[model samples]
Target: MPEKKLNQKRKEFNKEKMVGIWSLVSLEVTDENGQKTYPMGEDATGFIMYHPEGYMSAQIMQSGRPQYASGEVLCGTQEEMAAASNGYLAYAGPYQVDEINKMVTHHMAVSLYPNWLGDTQPRYLDIKGDTLEITSQPVFFNGKEHNTKLIWKRVS
Candidate 1:
């Protein structure tokens, strides 16, 4: 077998492994001091979808968020919006999977957090059966560096 053919095969295999809807199982952030926290509360609900065509989107939100009094996006008070935004994280864009490196880089085209827009976030991946665990590289969150681990289970 040729080396190029082998690499192509590997890439195809990696893409296949990621093409599916995955439900968030758990999300944990470990800070430099080794303290673990769930920024999205104990019960976070989210879904991440990977398309064979190399696009992806993700949305995660902490459970039990308070409802807006006006029930309108524009009518939300400053504190309401801030609370909502703090409890939710969403982004979508094209993605690339490096099979050899076992990493997935998301080219964020849009994100709820403005700072993340246009950023390329790379996550180390470990796929096992129905479970996919992605670990973000050390990221500064709340003035401290933390590594976030998101566990997902294949939904379809």
Candidate 2:
């Protein structure tokens, strides 16, 4: 019944709850004026995976993206590249969960957006049933501060 042993046990239990593949249900953002918007369209599809070894990756893309005319990754026109980049997001890196604080920080080693690379993004976590809701700290998007809420359902 030692305190250190109890704390370690709790950490293990919490870590176990976080390891799995989660499918994106919704990604919503509420601006400073309290208007909600779906930045990735209403039917965006994505998945986030958490590994027991403390790594995670997330990729979310807006649905119905048009195919490139050239069908080549580097041959897309400027307009096509812009449209594709604007509607897609991907990042991967090591992640750490603070069970006591109810937060998870994703140490971004790489990201689609250059500014996000090498950033430690912390998200408040709230897990309910099969859903995991992660709320980001107020972030500036399109010139306004917004808090993004990503709801994920356990897939594995």
Write down the TM-score of every candidate.
0.88, 0.88
RMSD (Cα, Å) of model 2? 3.0
lDDT (Cα) of model 1:
0.93
Instruction: Measure candidate 1: CA RMSD.
Output: 2.9
Q: CA shift at 55, candidate 1, in angstroms?
A: 0.6
The whole-model C-alpha lDDT of candidate 2 against the native structure comes to 0.91
Which tens-of-lDDT digit does each residue in 23-121 have in candidate 2? 999999999999999989989999999999999999999999997899997899999999999999999999998886678999999999999999999
Name the best candidate (by lDDT): 1
